[model samples]
Target: MEVLVKDFPIDFVVTWVDGQDEAWLKKYNQYSQQDVLDVRNARFRDYGIFKYWFRAVEKYAPWVNHIYLVTDDQVPKWLNCNNPKITVIDHKQIVPHEYLPIFNSNAIELNIYKIDGLAEHFVYFNDDMFLNRKVKPIDFFSKRGLPRDTAGLNAIQPRYDFDYIHVNNMKIINTKFNKKDVMKKQFFKFLNIKNLELNIYTILLFFWPKFTRFFDLHYPYSIRKSTMKRVISENQNEYIQTMKDRFRSRHDITIWLVRYYALVTGNFSVRSPRVGKIYDLLTTFGEAKRDLTNGKHKMIVLNDDANISETEFDSIVKDLKNLFEKKLPIKTEFEKED
Candidate 1:
C-alpha cells in the first residue's frame, strides 16, 4: 500500500473568471454578440473562471504545495483561502488592462516560469476540469504503451480560418460536402488554402475539442524550471499583447498552447492508457475502451485516486500514506513533535 512521492516541487496554475456578479452579469447580458464578447473578455481580464475552481483548490490543498489562481482583475476580498500552501496572485500585478490580452499565456507561462526556476516540475490546468482519481506525481510521468489513433482527429474545417471566407463561396466551392462536414473540411482546406500552414495552430485551438481534452491529465512534465522561466521572462511583454489580439482570451490562449505542446513537443502520449480513450476525441471515460480492438495492454485508471474532491481529500491522503508504506518505507515509530 506504500504510495510514492518524488523529490520535486509540484504545483498548479488555474484560471477562475468570476461571472456571477449581478451588475457585471446584467451588463454582460445586455450586449450584442460582440459587446457580450467584450464583456466576457473583461470578465476573463478580471476573473478567469470561479466557483468550480474555488472548490478544486480548497479540496486539493494537501496534494498541492502551491496553487496559483490567476485572475482578470484584483483578487476579490471575499477570497481568503486559508491554506498556507495556496497563493492567489492577480494577473494585474504583472501588467495593466489593455495589455492583458497579449500576455494571457505569458500570465500562466510566467507563473510556471517563476516556480519552475525553483521546483523540478509543475502542472497547469483550467477551471472546469476535475481529476477523477487520487494520484501521485510519479503516476503522471510514468510511461505507457503506444497510444491509439482515433478517427476525426484531423477532421477540422478551414474556411473559418479568419473573419473572411464567405459562406456563399464555401457553398459554391465545396458542394460535395454536407452542411455539417463543411466546417471541418473547410477549416482543413483553409489552412492550406494559401499554402500557408501558419494559422493551423489557431484552427486547432477553436475547433478541436478532442485534441484539447484528449490527455486531460495535467500532471508532471519534467522540464527544468529555469528554462521555462527564461521562456517567460524573455517574451513576456511582446507575446502577451500579441496573444491578446490573436486569441479571444485565456481559454483561447490555453487551447493554442496545448496544441503547441502537442505538435511541438514529442513528450506527450496520444492515448491515456489508463482510460483507453484517445486523448483528444469525443468520448467519455466509460466509453473509452469500447472503440478499441481487443489488445494486450491494460489501462490502470486512477478514478478517485487520480484526483479527488475536498470532501474525500483526507481519506485519500491516508491512502497515500498506505501506498507510501509499500513503495517508500520510513520508520513508523518516529515520535510526533510536541
Candidate 2:
C-alpha cells in the first residue's frame, strides 16, 4: 500500500480588477497616461466570464484549501465573499500604505506573500486563467509539496511587443545562478521529457554559459510562499522602486521573477507547459470559444488583446459570455443566490 501525499493544503490566490467601477475608474483616469503599455483598457475591463471562474474551481479543483480573491476594495456584485472557502483581500492587506492606490499588477504581486494565512504551497492566478477539467492537487504540487512547473529556457526576444521585463528577470537570474551549475543540479527537471516538447529554444540555448529568459507560458503559477518571500527579501531595493509605479513600466519585474526563482533553486518539480495556454481574443476568439466549449485544455487564458478595437472586443466578450453560460450555467457557493 502506498501512502499518498494527498493532505498537503494549498491555497489559491487570484488577482483581479474591475475597470468599470466608478471610484477605481476615477483614480485610474487621474493617474494613468495613455502611453503606458499596461494602461490599456483591455487589461482592466471584465467580461461576464469571471463568475464562471469560480464555478469552474468549485466544480473541478474542489480540494483547494482556501481561495484568496485579491482585489482593490472591489467585489463582483454577484460574488458571495463571505463564503468560508473564499476571502476577498484588498491591496492594502499585502501592499504597504505608501504604495496605496497602486494600479500596477507587478507592484500588487510583489506583496502577495504578505497575505494573512497564505499556505506554504499556493497557486497564483491571473483573473483570466481558468480550469477546464477536473484536476487533482497532484497537478499543481508534487508529493513533497514542490510546485510542478515547466523549466524550459529561451533567449530574450528584443522584438517582443510588450516589455523588457523578462530581460530584467534574466539579468537577475544569470547573476544569481550559473547555467551550468543549476543545470547540473536540475538536469532532469530542465531536460524532462514532458518539459522538452515546447522547449526547442531551451535546448538551442541550453549551453549559453548563463541562464537565458525562460519560456513564459500564460497560465497559473504553482509557487511556494517561502520562495516568494525569500526572492522579494533578496531583491528588496529594486522591488521597492518597482512598487512606486502607479502603473506598469518596462523596467519593473513581473511575477515571472518568483517563478524563475523557484526554477533555479530547485523548489519546483517538472510539469509539462502544455497544461494550459493563452488565447488572445483578437486573433484566437474562434479557437478560444471552441476550446472552451469542448474543454480542450486543462486551463486556458482568454486574453483581452489591446490591439483590437473595443467594438470587436465587446462582440467577442458577448460570445464568450454566452458560451461560458452554456458551459457553466449553475451558480455555486461562491455566488449569491438569485
Candidate 3:
C-alpha cells in the first residue's frame, strides 16, 4: 500500500502604508491648509493594527511560507527578516498609481491587484483585525465542503451596501474589452468566464459613515491569484477609469463586484464570529499567561493593559508551551526549497 500526502499550501500578504508617519502627516496638513489635524489619531490606529498583525502571523505562520508586505514607506528593519523566503514589495515597484490617496486602503488594493500573478494560494488580511491565538484552518470553514461560509447567512450589517452596482444589466465581454492572448498568459482562463454583470465583489462599494462590515461572500481572508487577475483585467477601467476622483465608493463597488464573482463560482469562504467567543478567548490568554512557564514559544503581546505583570505572563506562557508541544506535533520551522 502507498501513502498519499496532500499539501494544502498558502501564502500571506498584508496591507501596510506609511500614513501614520509624522512627516507625512505634516505635509498632508500643509497641502490641505489645515491648522489642527486628526491625522495624529491615524498613527495610534497603526500601532494597534500592526500589533495584531504580528499576532496573525504568529498564528498562521505554520502553514504559510512566503510573506509579502505591501507598502509605500521604507520597510521597517524588524519586518526585514534574514530569511530569504520572506519577500517585501514596495508599492512604487509593483503598481504605480500616483493619484490614489495614501490613506485610502482601497487604492492600495490595486498594488496587491497587480501582484496577483506571483502566488497561487494566498491570504489577504486587513491590518485592523486582531488575531490573538493560533487556530486550525479546518475549524474556520464548514465541514460540508460547501462553496461559501456560514457568515453570509447572517443578517447583513446595516453599514454594508447590499446593492452597490446593481448587477442587473451586465453585458458580454466584447472584442474591445477582451484580449485572449494576455488573458491566457496571466492564468485568467482558469476561472468560469462570463459576460459583464453587476460588480459584486467584496466590501468595496460600501462606504463608511453609511456602510461598513459587509457580510462579503468573497473570501475576505483568502484569494487565489487567478481570481485577482481575472477581475482586475475585466473591470480595471470600469472601476478606476478616473485618476482624478479620490472618492473610494466607486472603486470599492468595482472590487465588491469581484467578490460576487467568487461567491457565485464557489471560490470564496468566510469565518463567522461567534457570540462571546472573543471575550472568552481573550480571558483564556490572560489566565494562561499567568499560569505558564518560560522557554516557550515567543508570544507577541498586543494588549496595552499596564497592570499585567510580565513575570506572571512568562509563567503562563510556559504552560502554553507545554500544552502545544504535548498536543500539537507539527513543527512550525520554515523549510527551505532545494
Candidate 4:
C-alpha cells in the first residue's frame, strides 16, 4: 500500500561510534568506573559494516531524503563528505556542553530531534540496523501521519530490577498510572489515556501473562521529531532523569519511552510487525548463513555480543563481508572515490 508521502520528506539518522579512537578512549576510561566498562557502556567493535548499510539504504530506501550520521566527532575515512544527502553530525552540535564526550547511545538518542533542520518525519537506525528489502512509506507511517508500531507481549514476566533498564521503564509507567487503573485499562490497550476510567482488577492480566514489550525489536524506528519534542516537554522530570544517566543505568529510561508516549497520545498507529529472522553472531552463524542464502527476512541484525573471542569475532566479520559482497555488491554514492 503506497501512501502519497512524498511531501513528508522522511530522513534517516544513524548513531555510530569508533571505540578504538585514542581521544575517545581517553575520555571514556577517564569517566567510566571498572564496574560500568563492559556491559553498561557502548561496546565499540569494528565490523566494517557501515559501507554495506549505506549500500542497503541506497538500494532499498532510495526515497530517503537525507542520511544523518551522528557520531562523537568521528567519521569513516571512506565516507564522502561532499555527498549532498549525507550529513556527519558531531556530538557537540546537538548535545549540551556538560554532556560532551558522551559514550552512551541512550543519551545521544534523547538529543537527536534537536538536530538543526531535521525533517519532521525521520527513521532512527542503529549502525547495525539495515533495510534488507524495499519498503514503502506506508510501511512506516500511515496516510494520516501516524507512526506504525509493532510490539509483542514481553517474553518474560514484568518485574522490577535495579540492574535491568527495561524494568526501570516499567517502574516509571506503573508509578505514573494508578495500579488498578493500569490493570483495568489493560496495560497493552492504554495507548490513549484521555478517557480512561478508574477501576480495579484483582489480576493484572497485562503484566502477568506478559507485559507489553516495546523495546525488543532491532529495526529502524519510525520517529516524528515534533512528537518527541512534545513528549520531552510534557515529561520534564522523566526526560531529565533519562538525560542525567550518562551510561545505561538501571534508573535511566530508554528511547522506548518516546514510542510509548506517542502511542498513549494517539500519535501513532499499531501495526502487526513483519519481523524477519534475527541472527546473533555469538550463537547462530550457521542458521544466519542459511537464511541469508535463502533471503528469508526483509531485515537482519548482526549483533556483536561481548561473549565471543577475538578469533571468533574476526571470523564473523569475514562472513558478514562475504555475504554483503555477494548481496549488495554496488558501491553507493555516499562512499569516497577509490
**What lDDT would candidate 1 get against the real structure?**
0.37
The runs of at least 3 residues in candidate 2 whose Cα sits more than 4 Å from the true structure, single-residue gaps closed, are: 1-6
Q: Which regions of candidate 3 are displaced past 4 Å?
A: 1-8, 30-44, 48-52, 98-101, 137-148, 151-214, 217-220, 241-244, 247-251, 269-338
Q: Deviation in angstroms for 65 in model 3?
A: 1.7
Q: Count clashing pairs, candidate 2.
A: 0
Q: How accurate locally, in lDDT, is each candidate?
A: 0.37, 0.84, 0.41, 0.71
Q: Over the stretch 265-286, how does candidate 2's per-residue lDDT look in tens digits?
A: 8888788887887898889888
lDDT tens per residue, model 1, 1-338: 32333444566665555555555355445533433113333223222223323443343334555666665453544455564555666555544455443323423444444432234445555543433234454433333211111111223243333212122222222342243343354344323333233344445644533332222223323343444544345444434543454223322222223222222223333333233222221223333223212322222222222233344545443543444234323321111222
> Candidate 1: deviation at residue 94, Å?
3.3
TM-score per prediction, in order, is 0.45, 0.96, 0.54, 0.85
TM-score leader: 2
Worst 10 residues of 1 by lDDT: 144-153
- Give one digit per residue, the lDDT tens place, for model 4 in 96-131: 888666666777888899988899988898887766
How do the residues 136-213 of candidate 3 rate in per-residue lDDT, one tens digit apiece?
A: 444332333222232221113333232332321022122222223322332222222221111222223312222222
Rate residue 90 of model 3 by lDDT.
Answer: 65
Superposition TM-score, candidate 3 onto the true structure: 0.54
Poorest 10 consecutive residues of model 4 by lDDT? 194-203
- TM for candidate 2 is 0.96
Instruction: Show where candidate 1 strays beyond 4 Å.
Output: 1-6, 22-61, 74-79, 96-120, 142-156, 159-227, 230-338
- Among the numbered candidates, top lDDT falls to 2
